[model samples]
Target: MSSALAQTLIVMPAFNEEDAVAGVVAEVRAALRGVHVLVVNDGSRDDTVGEARRAGAAVVDLPFNLGVGGAMRTGFKYARAHGFRYVVQVDSDGQHDPAGVPKILDALQTHDVAIGARFAGEGDYTVRGPRKWAMKVLAVVIGRIAGTRLTDTTSGFRGAGPRAIEIFAEHYPAEYLGDTIESLVLAARAGCTIQQVPVTMRERAGGTPSHAPVKAAVYLGRAAIALVIALWRPPLTLQPEAGTTP
Candidate 1:
């Protein structure tokens, strides 16, 4: 195992994905060598905990369904407490490809945060209607805020280096859409450099999808609200962790 792999942790946030969690964990383990895989079971009523453990992933069970942001915050805290230098967010439903993780981690060498972008000319992933328009607007808006061009600002397949790991471990927002949208604003405001790499997204191996085509319009409104909330917040005062360059 390489030194970088040794210091990295893959944080999978699972919510009622008992059927797919184990397979996703196994795929991630197969793709990334010598990296710790921690699955945060977000109050799953099913056997997500047992499935993850059987798949060789360490599990952290939440008391209730705190959403992705809350579950991710727990993952960040685990990464921080356990002395991991990097944390990559992977979905438990198997949409995110594990093979793309190393590209994200490589970007984190210089950037404080790295996103696995879907619309960067490397994948067949496509969205339409209000959700698509909302995503484009968000990319432009948040891209300007971060002083960099971003093709997919709302991508969940992302990684945080040491500096961002320290900040997110304490300040990651738990609101709706906060994990992807608000969290970027928070990291950028906290003086974290953000970047993205092209990655292909796959269909979910099992379980029901979270978003439906019928909810695209609602998603547009909520996305706009989330962006506003992110921008309205005051800048975070962040200091670099000891032994890590800012």
Candidate 2:
């Protein structure tokens, strides 16, 4: 069926993940009911769209690959337009656990945005060598800017409430890994309360990670650049979110 009206929507952004997308979709469907699943097929030159569709998810095909940030924005646009009060983003690579999906959404009850922090509470996700150091640096920088303590600032498993849906749908960042820090900054600046819930990250089910080998260096460079942009961004007077005054 097409985009059905639902209270909560799960958005999975995918690319060249024919093998992984179907399983991820299945797990999500089994873990959560009454929530529509939409997979943004980022111009995959594979069977990602077909597999996702076959596994019972509505699929949206992009003309070209626009990275995770772009795919996620597409999902947010749908959520805002379709009257979804809650939106959860799940990774197609399967690093994000289906069990943690509910935790993120549950945390959104009291907070404007809920992040499944892989290093929060009882997590053990690893960031190796220089990557670990970079993550720590980003944690301090982003946490300071967002005015909240953050762990696993790069984790993508997150849930957003209505106002967050509105803000990101209209003004999402297009930076690499902006899905983490930039999105949080946008929400926090918009007066959204962001909170991190403990969650575990697993190894990717299939395909190589987009940020592998030399791409890791690129991730670091772009994160550094995006950090500067977030720092310079002035907070805007956002509309009321979380039932609080703006």
Candidate 3:
């Protein structure tokens, strides 16, 4: 936890994940030594806050459920307020592997944002049927919008350097679809380097995935529309005044 070593904060957004939060926190703590873990308990009906706290994470309880975008926004606000130099976003569903944290941190050595691409390497992780199709279509659209080849646009497992964190904290899209894509696109547009690393994703360990088949379809449809709207509008620019630190 020395000042010389970048202060890294790992943000896990959980909703009704009481069964998995403790295990997730333990894995992340073991994998990424010296990193602070912050759990955004997004109004979980279960005892997610208690479990996370028991697992040695700093828990931030939301007054009510605000979806994924709101939960992550809270994490970003915490990162900014606490002066963390790096922020890592990990899914609480247990799909993302904490073991890949080293690769992500290494990638950030030269890149502003390092994303874990589930489809990048040979692994047991598989997104099949309609979900796979939806991801493919979304990836193509995101790549076109960002003018960069993006293999995984929807993966929540990613790392953001201080510059990217400031930008996200200042203007994270309030909507779900726009929130994920806008962060990456904005980082690239601001001359921040973006890179990807291969990582394996596993099935959820506890509660069911929030995105069911029908829900996935609806999300894809909405995401497509949002992407079009986002493209029509100009990208937002970061307005950091001199000597200001986010």
Query: Which candidate has the highest TM-score of all?
Result: 1
Question: Which pairs of residues collide in model 2?
Answer: none
In candidate 3, what are the lDDT values of residues 16-70, reduced to their tens digit?
9988989999998887778899999988999999999999999999989987778
Pairs with backbone N, CA or C atoms under 3 Å apart (clashes), candidate 3: none
Compute the lDDT of residue 46 as modeled in candidate 2: 92
Tens-digit lDDT string for candidate 2 (194-214):
888998889899866787666
lDDT of 1 at 117: 99
In candidate 1, which residue pairs clash?
Answer: none
Better of 2 and 3 by lDDT: 2
- Tens digits of per-residue lDDT, candidate 1, 183-226, equal 99999998999999999999888877777778888998999899
Please give the CA lDDT of all the candidate structures.
0.93, 0.82, 0.78
Model 3 clashes, total count: 0
Q: Where does model 2 exceed 4 Å of error?
A: 1-6, 217-219, 241-246
TM-score of 2: 0.92
1 or 2, which is superior by TM-score? 1
